[model samples]
Target: MHLPGYPFESRWFTHDALRLHYLDEGDGAPVLMLHGNPSWSYLWRRLVLALRGEHRCIAPDHLGMGLSDKPAAGRHPFTLAARVDDLDALTGHLITERAAPENGWTLVMHDWGGPIGMAWAARHPGRVSRLVVLNTAAFPDPHGPRVRPALRLPLWLLRETRLGERLFLRHHAFARLATLPPFGLRDRLPPDVRAAFLAPDDGREHRLAVQRFVHDIPLGPGDPSWPLLVRAGETVAAFADRPVLIGWGLRDPVFDPLMLREWRRRLPHAQVHAFPGAGHYVLEDAHDSLVPAITAFLRR
Candidate 1:
């Protein structure tokens, strides 16, 4: 049975027995779409449908996020750098043996996906043909308030307390989505679709990814991902010659217009479009316009 609006084949690559889930579609240059916290590849469903016919669209569910194996801390390191490694392993598998690089590649990043995906791009600057940024940041801090209070808990408590894991992954994350303006999406997502987003973690062990995402905020130099994010920011600043397009949701509670302004300042040549009514999920709010705009940007 096909998952409507997200009709694609799932492919997995084992990184130390933990299978990671990813979507591979179409037959042209690869367009890698990396999703952020709380949402899985589900966030890119509409965009994949729009672009797959012309370009190969690969969207992955990071280790513990989507259909991928939800291993505990003992099984996997759910840190920001590990996520970047997962992306690298998956992309290398796709390009090295499976497909040949033609037009190079375009990277589409959102939320935490911004840092994880851009980190990989920064490593292989020559392979990055273009970038499409959506309501995400690769730089440090950006001076935003901490939204996920549940993550501030001590790491040991997060792992030992089973109820804490469930509350954060299922209840807290999903509840926030309901509050976003409807934008005609209320009826489109059925019960199962919602469950799929939250289903990876029913037990304490399965909740490691969500917990680590919170704990790995990297606010300062001591944080593991700080150096990688700093490098990514520097790369974005240097890659001003690359064609970049930024679609930002001004009303986003988490990543506000301030972050978008920083991106513009970094990539002064980027074409930016701001959606006032949309929140964090700008793609959901402005997919009709965003899809065409992204398609045109890539086509050029």
Candidate 2:
């Protein structure tokens, strides 16, 4: 879908005092799309355009990202649990008197959305009819033994230290880097499209969620989000018996081949499409193929 053609009107749901911006379109069974850090519901713009004709596409911006109200750390608890609660509240509000009596939503998640969506799914398995895993992780198992463990130190530094604050909040590393090659796209997004991605977290106040999302990465057992991850992982396993689709970007440095292997091991029956040339933003790189596969999965 083209950026200029992203024509859906903005919708909002109030959670406590905060308003979350979302898109609720189309008319059939529900398809809930959750995005990750440094990005917002805009990440799913293309998919939303593709599936809205046949599916009730509901995509929401987490409290601080996208057109949603951006708050500082003091205003909101920027934790994994908080995210789950927000999503729960939003979906519960939408599904009431609307969703079909028997059918539940097909959960599509990427990046941090994986854990947040899975945690909620663990609590309300009956609400999820199908599962779609993008280039992301929901399981509790932390990345790394040797190479990954060593890598954690730098990540921690980036999350905890002043340097991290400077780079992420002040410098806007994720906003600056994600629209570029390797981390975001194998091929760069067009200037306007790239601008759309960066527009949400364009300044320091907008950067709070990006910085907090990095800080909230549960690196070990002691991390606050670790237990949440454990529960989320069980949900991922439970969905293995249900229809699951794994669309992976092979060149993703974060959720790389090792990550895909673990997912395959757990959900052997899943329909997977691994894109060789794609990076972290698999949808952008592999849209031609992944979109059709996802539409077919929803159809089935």
Local distance difference test, each candidate: 0.77, 0.85
- Model 2: runs farther than 4 Å from truth? 1-3, 97-102, 142-150
lDDT of 1: 0.77
Candidate 2: residue 121 Cα off by (Å): 0.5
Among all windows of ten consecutive residues in candidate 1, which has the lowest summed lDDT? 178-187
Clashing pairs in 1: none
**What is the TM-score (0 to 1) of candidate 2?**
0.94
Candidate 1 structure, TM-score to reference: 0.86
For each of the candidates, the C-alpha root-mean-square deviation to the true structure, in angstroms, is: 3.9, 2.1
Task: Give the per-residue lDDT digits (tens) of candidate 1, residues 44-95.
Answer: 9888988888899989999988778988676787888889899888888887
